[model samples]
Target: MDWSSKTVMVTGATAGIGAATALRFAEAGATLIITGRRKQRLETMADVLTSAGANEVYIHRFDIQKKEQIAAVVKNITADTLSVDVLVNNAGLSRNFSPMWEDNTDGWDDMIDTNIKGLLHMTRALLPGMIDKNSGHIINIGSIAGHEVYQNGAVYCATKHAVKAITASLRLDLFKTNIRVTSIDPGLVETEFSEVRFYGDKERAETVYKGFQPLTAADIAESVFWSASMPEHVTIAEMLVLPTDQASATMVYKK
Candidate 1:
């Protein structure tokens, strides 16, 4: 199951699950194509992976919010020198929960654009190459929120739900092709995800993982590896991951 020369691309590669996943693939000897909008952070991550064991590492720094930029990135990556073996659409955004009718427009736009539209743009950009080769894997980082919505999470939930639906749709449409599509839906992960969603409110972000165990970035990273490493004939479709003490989105028990 060694990746040897296979090239894998991961967005949101600067940190969290994407960073961890990139490290895993790099260790397994994959040629890595890592991307994120953050410049220095992404460069530092590539340094770590290069030190680990990656054969060749390429970096693309671009904001997912810019659709044209995403297109340019795809062209650059797919140039004569590079071809993708796997594409992980890990870039996403979440927002604080607020009353739907009481002026939630700002959060709404960010969540919709980053979470939903951004993912779609990346997929469209990269899938043609995968289809041409008749082989590739796509691992999307979805959330339990996609399955069950909580208060103050209207737009976030909507975007994730859209993820769930799109993952299914893409799988169906690509049935004839050997491209693998998977959704790694994690319950609650103690990552920068919460801080961003809570708008840098450290306390509120910390509260999400209080008094209980939550999944970590490495946990989901291993899941992504498993999904990608499966036999060409097997696709792990959708996965729901939670800590042992958790049951569902709203049913986590914390002390």
Candidate 2:
């Protein structure tokens, strides 16, 4: 694919996999639209992405958990007359590790609102343009948890499972169109993920990858880029990426 002429939009681009993916595309010389809640971080990223060779860089500051915020961002994109060639739904989180019976309702709500509802809102917002143009790609960042359940992660897993289902069903929904949909399901990745999940307990988060090499944000970014770069005739419907030391959500070879 000639990325130089394409415009890519990535949600949650302020950090983690989203930032890496944006940087990857920028290095390919693509125009970029990166959205996140941190205005300062977004500003810094825009400069960094531009320096990384993005043809042009744009940033939108908004909280994905709110539909109003998402709609406002979409309105701005439309007003700017920017047509996104690829949309990466990358903004998501896990609030805590409490099991279902003892989990905070607030945490549950956070996970659902951001992981599931946010994704739906963003996709619905951008999908019409893709359909109207009859050309586009939607890459959803899923997780290994989507395929398996684990203790104390029931709510987070449920959200990702929903992502998996949505991605599959969306492919069937758009089968007749020229548009493409893909899900990139990754295993453990060492980023803010653990810290966020553990509520900023850096010591606790560090132990999650103590004895083995977990995937990095850039590693997942490379997978996302590869999926997006495939021929138009080819659609990578789903991908499950894991560190060699990790076999499943709960099975980590830490030795």
Candidate 3:
């Protein structure tokens, strides 16, 4: 439970689940390295983390979609004498909700680039240090979409499905070592996720969570903290979290 000696790197720490997760670790006394594309927000989050009890907070501004940027940041962290004890790959997005044939190609590009490629780049950049030390936890923020494909969300679903595959494969690959890999998939969380998916349409986004008690960013954050705080010998391979009214990706019971 004492994370004072640990260092945790969280991608997409500007808002939502990423921000919540960073704060959770901070409350546990971890040294935090938080990254996001928004410079100002990342800085603000760093300050918040410091105020929340983190031993140290480092803010890095870069798009995870860029491999060079990821590598450069990781290198700088290493140079600073910080060995990451946990890596949270939570930088991801869902662009649109259209059938595969009618969907815009740009949406596809954004989803694939951010959801799949971004996760790979961060893992690739940080896994080396963990392997050399033979200790680390990689917590991926996947989705229920990874387990089931919903109507008009084919590409987004595919990207999450790939997350599931990658998480499994990465765990197996690290089985010989003490490195741990886990995917935390959530059904419905009331956050900016819906707003972003709807291209900033507030009303439309509100409809998605209407008449239902959806999970919050803090809920998922708690799960991440729990998974990372487990005994070194225990590895939780995968966890699927959903709201009480939700059963799966497509089955949400609204009041």
Best by lDDT: 2
TM-score, cand. 2: 0.99
Scored by Cα lDDT, where does model 3 land? Answer: 0.93
Q: For candidate 1, lDDT tens digit of each residue in 1-255?
A: 669869999999988889999999999999999988899998898899999999889999998878999999988886847889988889887876567886358878888888889899999998888898898988898989889988777888889999999999999999889999999999888889889887889999899899999988999999999899988999999999999879987898888
Tens-digit per-residue lDDT, 1-255, candidate 2: 899999999999999999999999999999999999899999999999999999999999999999999999999998998998999999999877976788778989989999999999999999999999999999999999899999999899999999999999999999899999999999999889889888889999999989999999999999999999999999999999999999889999999
CA deviation > 4 Å runs, candidate 2: none
Q: Give Cα distance to truth, residue 195, candidate 1, Å.
A: 0.7
Instruction: Give the poorly placed runs of model 3, Cα more than 4 Å off.
Output: none
Clashes of 1: 2
Candidate 1 weakest ten by summed lDDT? 95-104
lDDT of residue 98 for candidate 3: 80
What alpha-carbon RMSD in Å does predicted model 2 have with respect to the real structure? Answer: 0.7
lDDT of 3 by residue, 151-202 (tens): 9999999999999999999988997899999899998998899898988999
